[model samples]
Target chain A: MSPRLFRSRPARVVPAVIVAIVILAIAAALGWVAIAAIATGGSGDSALSSGFSGFASLGAMTWGAPPVITAAVIIALLGLILLVIGISPGAKRNIGYRTEAPEHIERFEVILPTSALASLAAAAADSVDGVSSVRAASNASSTIVTFSTPVRDNDGIRRDVDAAVTQRFASIAFNRTPTVKVRVQRRQA
Target chain B: MRRMAAGANRTGLIIVGLISLGAGFAALAISFGLAATAAPGLSPDAQLQPIAAVFALPFSAGIALVAALILAMIGVRWLAVQVPRKDSAKPLRMQEDSRSGVTTVTANVVAAAVEDDLEATPEVVDAQAILRGTARRPELILHVDVDERADFDTVVADIAERVACNCSQALGVPLSAVGVEIGIARSRQRRQRSVQL
Candidate 1:
């Protein structure tokens, strides 16, 4: 197996499950109608024959009938929605890291989720000497670190927090280094 | 992470979508009298008796039953694939020559050993591993949770150099591929107790 450097997209499980259920339901209905028709020997009053008779009533409706047009429109829209879901790639769930290994051996690919990256950034920022508390959020492209301190001299503390978070991210060697943004808030001691 | 039936889902969606789109468009076309040229009596106001009359045929019930069975099979297959799969390799035959003796190792056994080794690493709170590929070209995939403040680079390097080398040496074959997924552990609840004073 080769290394997979790219992030994996989420499987469209919900849509797939729904579609499968719909198919099963349709199959069940078809089976029921077929059985009813077979048992009744295709009599006019049989469920399947009656079902068709009911459908034949729709022939009385003009092409411009509200119900006919609405059903057609709804079916078309449902198909369009399914097509879109099938084509669209879902959200990426992890960020790949650059691998560093000896040339003779296969390099190990590393990955981290955005939530984990954010936690790492927050931990690094919290460890900064003057930072009393910290919060961080990360995406594929960037991370924002926000820290609150009870110190009046916050400029240096902000820089230190920024450096700490940046160093942590650098050590991970992410394939695409997310830019770090730091914000500091001051509180009375 | 386990493998998903994404390809199957996409294919199913595409097939269903095309059928639905075609049916809807055909209905719309007939409603608008667009199909009048092909079937003269087909119109929005046309009696559906002619269309529904096919079901009244002698063999229509058998055809419907067959179609239902086919649809049911498709539905069951789709539902079955929803279960996640690991797709791990089969038991590895590690013996140099089968004439002398054969040694077989299950993927789970190797994966468990790798997980134990990973958890032994400093600051790694939890670890999971899966071994794939043949014995000659093995692949290892690991997911490890380490303390947020742990040195990320050192831990990664340790896995790449030490853990992988140890596994390769044990198997007597160099790993063809290795994948590590790192996560941050905020809680110390699962941390290993090194010393009990």
Candidate 2:
């Protein structure tokens, strides 16, 4: 079993695969059409040539037709989706860290996944006294801790949660320390 | 795989997307009668004599060439995908003999041994290791799930120290980097449930 499983970015890969498939299909279709046209001595009445004539006749298509409008909308939507994916800022999975040892030591880096960070945050939050339950979510910039309590004194609970989370973050020498946000809410009975 | 796919295909996708978008918008505008200029080349009803006149031997040859190139490009991309990623690190050099040839150990084998040893530890419920990079400068990525009651820091530091020593001493390949990902093991009581009709 390999521990170093490479993470995939669906935002980029899915659209790319779609585009590739579309290109391949078009190329194949055009190739077949070309072959048919050549075999039929460039006859306009040939099946392949007639089929392509439909595409070549697209300019004369009326905007009032249901099918044409639908196609235009679909095509435009697909393009918009692709454009959004291309422009969006991609999320990186690993956290960078530099190892410190003796002088003249070899330089190497370590990466921790966001899942690990979330687990650490959860563990830290769970240990707090008034926190009856804790749910932690972490991203590149911050970790948000949502805790509930049966009793009042939200301020006290918040202070404790902040201290615990801060201490946990301080303990680990992370390359990028995410800001911890604690939300103390009343627990449901 | 997602990372690999994106790295290989993102640029081509953007280009194709842009073209599709532009063509789609152009079609919509033309159909709506917004543009004043006539789309002569697009309509089959037009006098396609000029374009059709050029579609003789040279057009056939060019289209055939383009079709072949497209298929070839797709084939190459497919072939490149078939090659597995470089997962296993460089082989550890063991015994070098005059007659029996050189004996080497694979990184996966060492990783497996380390995983097994770590799993045997009291604090660790499960463990996995992946070795990557050259043997001279290898990286060890460890995923260790600790017992719920176990101290997180203690378990992590213990696993790191032990794995480093074991790999260095046994395989004679000091790790250039070690990444430890700690997870809390789920309780067995919660997992085991009885159902009755």
Candidate 3:
């Protein structure tokens, strides 16, 4: 492929290429050992010795032009992969959590409770001091809140959510670690 | 250092795991092919032999599969990281309003000192106060809980005098701002927190 494709987005191609190199290395080692053993009439020691010796005397083993070109291509592909991974020192995580909870519950014949997991989560969230308001997702099990006055983006709000979720979900059979999102908002001061 | 650790994140560690897993699978597949070839009965073709299959299978197909599997691992990790960010809500937090050695205080220190000096007045049976208004000036809202037969005006007058004496000599807060009010004539047994202003 073009150099632009790999450079612009290394995440897309690096894993594929790394996997390809691993495949090629295993195939080469197997091919060398098996071919050597057959040529030496099932002698395991001779086959093993020759596999290493072959790489040591790289250009000495005679092969067809097509086979040689294929090997070259494989080697170049492996090199490109190593380069990409080396440059990308670490991984980057984008924000947010997404979970799917049940639609309805049948707790001791109290069927179809319109008041859902998300609604309770919102209520618990509102109880927090710095929290201005909470707004859950359309899916009742999922809750998202607008913090009318945010203390800090992830630190303050994230801690409060963890506590609030534990308190609110304490009573239900809908046992889950509910995802808590804190969005900063402003109220009329 | 903390920022660097955060930046390295979950995705980077996942990539490392994927590469290691890919290498392991490729080795296993190549070894399995080698084992098959060492036994001649499994050979499909005489000339193009079982040995040829061992030599070629790993390079042609097995390596490719391992690479694709590693890419799939990356995708799976990415999905795992996205779920929690979308589900946040209003959370609780705390801040220090003032840091003068106390974690929390429900009473004014200066007002408490003034109430101590109010005890000398004989007619002032009970007294309570609070720092009120926008300036938080100490105001005396005294509750002289009198008996049914006692003079209410006489008791209020004594409490007022006590508050004035304490203000000028002890607290130095203006005596004019110290307004006293007679609350309930109830006993102290049923009362909550009360401070003499």
Model 3 chain A worst lDDT window (10 residues): A103-112
- Model 1 achieves a DockQ score of 0.45
Model 1 chain B worst lDDT window (10 residues): B187-196
lDDT tens per residue, model 3, A1-189: 211101112143434344444554555555555455445544332333333334433333222234443554555455445445545543321111121211111110111112233444555665676766666542323446555654444457657865766655443333233455555565543
List candidate 1 segments past 4 Å from native: A1-7, A42-47, A50-53, A56-62, A121-138, A143-167, A180-189, B37-39, B186-197
Ranking by DockQ: 1, 2, 3
lDDT of 3 by residue, B1-197 (tens): 00111123324534544554455443333333432465643222222223333433323333333444554555455434433231111221212353544342233443455455444555445554443321223333332333322333454444444455554444333432333333223334322433447
Off by over 4 Å in 3: A1-107, A111-115, A138-141, A150-154, A175-178, A186-188, B1-197
TM-score of each: 0.82, 0.67, 0.20
Which of the numbered candidates is closest to the native, going by highest TM-score?
A: 1
Question: Per lDDT, what order, best first?
Answer: 1, 2, 3
Runs off by more than 4 Å, candidate 2: A1-11, A14-46, A49-77, A87-89, A101-105, A129-132, A185-187, B1-4, B25-86, B90-100, B120-123, B146-160, B181-197
The deviation in Å at residue A148 for candidate 3 is 1.9
Q: Which digits, one per residue and each the tens of the lDDT, describe model 2 over residues B1-197?
A: 11154445555556656877887786566545554356544432333234344344345534554775676577457435533364667776677553777777888898899899888789888887877766567666677777544655556555556656677667565666666665566545532442446
Candidate 2: the clashing residue pairs are none
